[model samples]
Target: MKRPTTGRSRHSGGPNVGRPGFAWALPATIFFALFAIVPLIGVAVMSFTSWSGLGSPEFNGLDNWNKLLGDKVMMQSLWLSALLTLLGVVIQTPLSILLGVWAAGQQKNRAVLSAIYFIPLLLSSAAVSVLWRALLDPNFGIPGQLAGIFGGDGNLLGSQAGAIAVLTFVGAWQFTPLHTLLYQGAARSVPPVLYQAAEIDGAGTMRKFFSITLPQLRNTIVTSGILMVVGGLTTFDTVLILTKGGPGTDTTITPYYMYRKAFQSFDFGVGSAIALVLVVIATAISLIMVRATGYDKMNSAQEGI
Candidate 1:
């Protein structure tokens, strides 16, 4: 009974429907290629060449990697970086969870407490590093003066072990607030009915936290742990400004070591290789964490919620 059959289908009423989908995605695709793909390819290529920032890179097969394997300082730097990451995850996770729970329960002063906790996140890493440096100074700083009262030195940054510990402390101090915020959000999102039912069943605070709160927040804890581990591994600015990888190569993590290799030693090839190695290490650790935490299953369950 129709007068004529047109080329247009009922599912797609307009001629431009399918074409526009691709057109809409083209810009984002191009931008990603330009910024992410291009730079990554450049780094990979540069890793195989010997280049000082000024001239054409000479192709030099696996020389940089071979040298990296034998370089004791580089090995030490990688080990130190891993140790720092481990220390950060172990120390920060529980503290962040506790702070998050405390803040989440504060009905009257929640906003004020959150704002105070967020202050460290606002400051630049360089500024935080400098502030701590002066605070920990042995000769004329407050810590030094306090130590003098007890016949001890406050120059914690002057010894290798002490410097690494201070660096770890500074890292935890600055980043814990972020994880706390994340945990607090996760805690607040738990259904109020669950807590009400727990209270009716005579569950105490500790019991409810362990039975209800922690299970709900498991994914968040894993996410925060992964982020802290990655940040610990790649951190450079704070360590650079505070310790400069000093106290006899004690605090030199991979990122700082990479910077020293590229700029100080004028060896971009080796630096790029180190950068790639760090990327591999981070990726492997993240994959392991995701698998161990059952992150995919948790994500699906959260989505259903």
Candidate 2:
């Protein structure tokens, strides 16, 4: 038997009527639309045209996209970007997590350690590039001087492998500290009682880490991995200042490829297509990673609460 609601108890209105504080949503929505949604739409539209940065864009359908299929340089850039992402994820992720766990355990004198770890991230990428350039200079650079000492004529950043190594070194240096901070935060959030219980159960450090810490930090690891992957894919400034996509395109990533296409070759059509491809790849990979890590389920559980 349904009871009839009185005027004071109920009214004809939407669910949000009772929530008077939801007014903030409107402003956020407007901001997102203006900044994010509008720019994405513009990029999508621009990706289909041939604009010279001055003239009106003429729609060329899928010609730009088709050009991607046969572009050797673009293919090369894609390969390098993929390699960078792979190396970053493989090298940085576990190291960051381990260091983060260690950092969390260091209750005393952590400030000094934190400052040391954060120095790389604190420096600008351009500054790091300039520094590394001087260090790796062929004639009078530290590395070259070291090679001279060793009687081995070696030039870092002169070969393809060297360039890749330099790029990876720069990336890991800047990003690992931030990633460690992420894991450190996550590790600290873990309940102390969990460790006590594990200790009582005779669980060793390795066992506890695998059965407890790793499981608890699954989300942070995924987030850090995604960031590393995205940064690897879109990295341009360091590579630009360091190698200029040179020594025969050894260090060229997709973003650098896009820059060369648009500004160097004056091919806006192809550049936009590459940009769109980058967007799609980044979006798809991020979604896949989030889904794989069960982040959506976690969000859903939080929402249900």
Candidate 3:
């Protein structure tokens, strides 16, 4: 027999039934604060001080920043980084989109080809740079063998234009696979009904792609674009192994410049300043992109249908 509830009627669900509590997020928050936040704070503080590799830091106010502002090399490095990043976006985005859509098709051979295409992503940045370096060598490399195409001497690394072009091409070659994988996964998630409806409407492949598939992949495009922009901005390993910021600092993007200052020149203070600046810039750009693209709203691309 059930008694009538007089003082209070009970709720069927638990108080926190549908919501996650703070405990669920506590571990990740702690980990991020310990690693990312702590280091960022240290770098920010270190940027205001003067330190060689050996001594304790001495506060010098804005001296490091002032010096950086006046440095022509620093200014030029910013321009070069922007140019390389732009080149990467312009060249890789559309290519990845096309490859990803095609790779998402119901073809048996795609499995084999996708694996082969992803091999570059498996290789380390250092290894890829070294392989290309050897392959572009004047006397012993592919360039030398195809001297008619690369010019008689095949000295691609000896000039500014040639070195920049090589860097951009290698970057695109190595990273495009990653972006393609992003798009491929996104492409697969698109509902089949959309495509079926388009076919019934007599929409051809190109028409369906631009009208339906591209719209469905909008969020993924934004995500991939952010990754590309940030990765290109901080490119370091390939430059170190392939160009060494060489042909006389022509390829010295900011990350390599920071490495040169901190490791080679032992200017810890200046290095910290550069590192902090980069962090701020990258963070700000990411935030701007998210805000501008409506990514922060977290709305579904397929919301209407």
Q: Report clash pairs, candidate 2.
A: none
The runs of at least 3 residues in candidate 2 whose Cα sits more than 4 Å from the true structure, single-residue gaps closed, are: 1-32, 148-151, 289-305
RMSD of each: 5.1, 4.4, 5.8
Model 2, 141-218: lDDT tens digits are 877667746345557777888788888887888889999999999999999999999999999999999999999998
Residue 6 Cα positional deviation in candidate 3, in Å, after optimal superposition: 30
lDDT (tens digit, per residue) of candidate 1 on 39-151: 77777787899999887988899999999999999999989998988988988899999999888875878878888998988889999999999888788787667874634
Candidate 2 lowest-lDDT run of ten: 1-10
Q: What is the Cα-based lDDT of residue 117 in candidate 2?
A: 94
lDDT of each: 0.86, 0.84, 0.89
Candidate closer to the true structure by lDDT (higher is better), 1 or 2: 1
Off by over 4 Å in 1: 1-20, 148-151, 285-305
Model 3 residue 243 distance off true place after TM-score fit, in angstroms: 0.5
Per-structure clash totals for the candidates: 0, 0, 0
Residue pairs with backbone overlap in model 1:
none
lDDT score of model 3?
Answer: 0.89
TM-score of each: 0.86, 0.84, 0.86
